[model samples]
Target: MIIDNGKLNKQQRKAVETTEGPVLVLSGAGTGKTRVITDRIVYILENNLAQPWQILTLTFTNKAAYKISKEISISDTSFKILNSKELWMGTFHSICLRILRRNFEHIGLKQNFLIFGEDDQKSVLKHVITNLGLDIKEYNPFVWVDKISFEKDKGIQDKYSNKELNFDKIYTAYNAQLARLNGLDFGDLIIKVLELFQIAPDILEKYQKQFKYIMVDEFQDTNAAQMQLLQKLTGNNFNICCVGDDDQSIYS
Candidate 1:
């Protein structure tokens, strides 16, 4: 199958054609960053580098994932075998949820475990704060929820510190409550998957071998947990392409 390069400029063409090793495409707004990503996938497919399922495409938001999926689906009519649904593509939390669901047993969780939303997490935190004999007015559940989430995003667990309140006790109790209810918050999703990979080397090997190529969109916005997850998956095969503008980074 002959791939078309008429729409791409020199840099975009290079980003699409470089399928071997790690490739990083830094671009600003309206510079065809998304186009480069979609076209790169097409180039890999048309060249017979990997099957549709072997390419792991990840984005930071569900909207971005949907856009990428839609672009790949309608990008070329000749590539009938290229079904975007078959590709492992989704947001970081969504992808982690998929991994955790399949390997729930390895992480001491049921297959039907619940994912707690913000309100549910706040409720759990409130209960923990009250049970610990702390005043909810002073130790606000809402504030604690954000605090815990920030720490988890940094890959820290049970070791958080603060001068004002006994956050360590609260963090421990909050996690214990979550485990009792067989639930995981959004932050737990990424860390739990990381935990699963650490305990189950065979499972990690299975995915590492399965995903021949990995592509990350908005790579500048990835947090520590997300970065670790990417590192673990790409440890064996480093065929990854990350496209993002450092100036557009939201994380400072």
Candidate 2:
């Protein structure tokens, strides 16, 4: 095999060789987790198990994604997998951005809508709070931002619940301002994608079929919303490989 995983330990080799069904690798730090994932990807391409586009590799951070992509590309220069344009390798948010760009209209967003950063999000919230005649001291901008993020992560829309600072009102107005600006906050990435998939079955099926094999790095860190998105993507095929160490998991 050109994608030699000979140096991998016994457990890592097993992970690379098991190219069928759902596979989970739970190991401590410095156990060559990334190596096994990259090797498995290369093994799939080399063995003609699936096309590059059919393989979906997800990472938590852009740096890890880039590193994996780089390692795979340089693993073997002769392999055509490097030239495959269908390769889907990126962070969850980045992958969702790509999907949204193509099908944003279904979710009431333009294809070219803006993604607001922390500063812009706070600015928008401040505007909404100010117009509502609420003091920022009582309803701190950071607190409100975190509250909205928490709710969005749970796939819940801000209902006008009666609260001391009227958080519901602020959230509603904040969303209105975002809509007017044609923008979405950071937390909206996963939430919007989940919403899109739930509302549009055809779109979900399209991706589910396109990606035959799904691989997730740092699986333990996945939040509830991310897990929901993964479930939607892996409907029936269930060719998923999750690699992580629960012992080292800082987030659940």
In angstroms, the error of model 1 at 60 is: 1.1
- Candidate 2 lDDT at 220 equals 84
RMSD of each: 1.9, 2.3
TM-scores, all candidates, are: 0.95, 0.92
- Highest-TM-score candidate: 1
Candidate 2 Cα deviation (angstroms), residue 137: 0.9
- Tens-digit per-residue lDDT, 15-128, candidate 2: 888988999998888788877788888888888999998999989899998888888777764565785346898888898888888899998997689999888888898888
lDDT of 2: 0.84
Worst 10 residues of 2 by lDDT: 156-165
Score each candidate by Cα lDDT.
Answer: 0.87, 0.84
What is candidate 1's TM-score against the reference? 0.95
Deviation from native of the Cα of residue 205 in model 1, angstroms: 0.8
- Candidate 1 error regions (>4 Å): 1-3, 156-164
Q: What is the overall TM-score of model 2 with all chains considered together?
A: 0.92
